[model samples]
Target: MPRQKNAFAHKKNTNENNQNKNSYQKKPEVIQEQPEPFEDLIPRIERLEAKFDEFDSSILEVRKRMEQYAKEREEEKRQEELERVEAEKAEKAAEEAAEEARIAAEKAAEKEANKESQKENEGSKENQAPEKNSKDSNKNKNSNNSAKPFNNSNKNNKNKKRYK
Candidate 1:
């Protein structure tokens, strides 16, 4: 029985080895080692480097354009500030001019009012003088008329006959 067991174990080991050999042997790995010549690879490497250089140059160009755009934007803001300052100056000048005009108009109106007042004073004086003179003349004439009867009595008294 021991010999038979030994023979069965030997047969199992031989079968596993055979399966491993058969499975591993059918497809052999092929190693292809073709050494590329240095001259042929140089142009390919140079083309790849040129492509990388072109990409880098494009990135640099974009950066330059962005910087220029930023500068232009800053300049535009400065121009806007200048314009605002100019507008403020113009507005102030206009306001001052308008104020001066208003003052001139007011002064002219005041002068006219003073002239009118002076004229009114002169006219009132001229009108009042005649009224006062006429009143004085009327009083004198009434006094003269009342005294005429007294004057005639005095004159006729010399012609009367005296009764003792």
Candidate 2:
């Protein structure tokens, strides 16, 4: 009977040891490992942020310069267009003035020619009046001689010399 009791006790002890070994093989609570934060890493991140800010400022400055250049080019184009228009207007005015002057000069020359023709007509009339008077005097002398007998004025002169 004593031998049976001791054998039972040894079996129970063996079972307990097997259960402890199985529990040790697996962890009851899991431990998570985290990396430690370093002081140097913070400064590196700050430097990267500063470089991004600088790049943004440079892009803004480039945009502003491009806008200024566009405005200047537009102003120059407008000025050139205005100058071309002014030149065209001035040329048209000059042509109009020259045409007016030519018309006035032609009118003056025509008037002078008319005056000269009128003067020539008056001179011809004066010459005709003198010719008419001379022809009338010759007709009167021819009629008086025809009315008397043909006598020589030399016979009268001979009689006058005998009397003296």
Candidate 3:
């Protein structure tokens, strides 16, 4: 029975090999495309090269415009920085001027106060000088009156002694 199975398998393999051989013999024909003529392709190649050149020129123009834009932006930034610095300087100057004005006002106020105090001192000194002079004159008059009474009493005593 094993020998019979082996023979059947051998027959199946041989049939498959025969079918593969027949398929190979009946292969489909391959059609080859002919290359285009050089004259016909030259214009097409030139058109492609022209388009490439146009693209390259457009790219260069864009790069130049971008560089110009960058320079413009840098210049604008520098202008803005200069303006900011000037504004700060102006503000600082204004602050300094204000401080100077405040100091000047303070000094003027102090001078006015000093002038007022000096005027008050001079007025008081003038008022006290008159009062002091009046008091001294009164004292001198009282002393002179007391000395005249003593002289009159001594003269009266000498007259009484002569009459006795």
Candidate 4:
């Protein structure tokens, strides 16, 4: 029985060896090197973080400049609106002044026409008074001359007979 058991075990061992040989051969594994530690990568991380911070600062500066430009644009718009309003008001005032001047000119022209008509009336009245005075003086002189009109000299009178 011991010789039979020894033969059976030897056969099992040979079969195991044969099965292992029939499998695909694996390539020898090279010794893999370990990755670098965090202590070695700290400087690179710090450099990348500093670059990120610089990018963030640059973006912030750009945002601030954009806001400043927008504010300046708004101020310019406000100034233009104010100037437009002032120009409109000035134009309205000028129109009103022109209207007032037109009214005043019309009044002045009326007054001048009235003064001219009054002067004409006064001149006609003055002329009539002088003519009336001259006619009255002529009438008085003619009446006085007619009242003493008996001075005559005649040579051939029958009532004055001469004996020479």
Predicted model with the maximum lDDT? 3
lDDT of 3 by residue, 1-164 (tens): 45554556657778779988899788697988867669788989999999999999999999999999999999999999999999999999999999999999999999999999999989988887555558778889888887554458778999999999
| TM-score versus the correct structure, for each prediction | 0.50, 0.50, 0.52, 0.53
Give the winner by lDDT: 2 or 4.
Answer: 4
Q: Whole-model Cα lDDT per candidate?
A: 0.86, 0.85, 0.89, 0.86
Q: Total backbone clashes of model 3?
A: 0
Off by over 4 Å in 1: 1-46, 130-164
What is the overall TM-score of model 2 with all chains considered together? 0.50
Residue pairs clashing, model 2: none
lDDT of 4 at 79: 100
Q: Mind giving the per-residue lDDT tens digits that candidate 1 earns over 39-120?
A: 7789899999999999999999999999999999999999999999999999999999999999999999999999999999
Report the C-alpha displacement of residue 159, candidate 2, in angstroms. Answer: 89
Minimal lDDT window, size 10, model 4: 155-164
lDDT of 4 at 13: 75
Off by over 4 Å in 4: 1-15, 18-33, 36-42, 125-164
Clashing pairs in 4: none
Q: How close is candidate 3 to the true structure, as a TM-score?
A: 0.52
**Per-residue alpha-carbon lDDT of model 4 for 1-164, expressed as tens digits?**
45554546657778779868976676668998876678788999999999999999999999999999999999999999999999999999999999999999999999999999999989998887555558778989889887776654454353355533
